[model samples]
Target: MAGFDDITKKAQSFLQDGKVQDALKSEKAEDVSDKVFDGVADAVKKVTGGKYDDKIDKARDEADKRIGNE
Candidate 1:
C-alpha cells in the first residue's frame, strides 16, 4: 500500500541519517538515560494516538543505543 511504502521509506531514511547518529553520539547524549528516551517515546506515542508507536519505539531504541550508555 502507498501508506506502508511511505512509512518504510521514512524508516529507512531515519536509519540512514548519519547526522542524527553523530548527534546522538555526543557527550550530552551519552549522559541521557534509557529511561528518558523511553519516556519521550511514550509521550510521542501518546501524542500520535498510538498510530506510530512501533516506529517511535524502534527509533527510540536505535537512538538510545547510539548514545552507547544504555
Candidate 2:
C-alpha cells in the first residue's frame, strides 16, 4: 500500500515540475502571500521581540515571489 514515502515522493516530483508553483499562481491562491506569510512573519517577529522585522519581511517577500504572488 502507498504510504508517507510515496506521498512525499509524489509531492517532490510535482514541485520539481513547477505544478505546485503554477497552482499557487491561480487566482484562488493569489492572496496566499498576505494570508499566510504575514502571519508567519508576525509570529517570527513576536518571538524575536521584533528584532528581526526587517530581515523577516525581506525573506517573506522572497518567499512570496517563489509562491508566484510577487
Each candidate: what lDDT? 0.81, 0.81
lDDT of 2 by residue, 1-70 (tens): 5798899999888887766777777766768666798899999999999898999999988887766445
Q: Give all TM-scores, in the order shown.
A: 0.51, 0.71
Give lDDT tens digits, candidate 1, residues 28-64. Answer: 6766656688889989998999999889988987887
Locate the minimum summed-lDDT window of 10 residues in model 1. Answer: 26-35
Query: Model 1 residue 48 lDDT?
Result: 96
Poorest stretch of ten by lDDT in candidate 2 = 25-34
Q: Which ranges in model 1 have alpha carbons more than 4 Å from their true place?
A: 1-32
The clash numbers for all candidates, in the given order, read 0, 0
- CA RMSD of all predictions: 8.1, 3.0
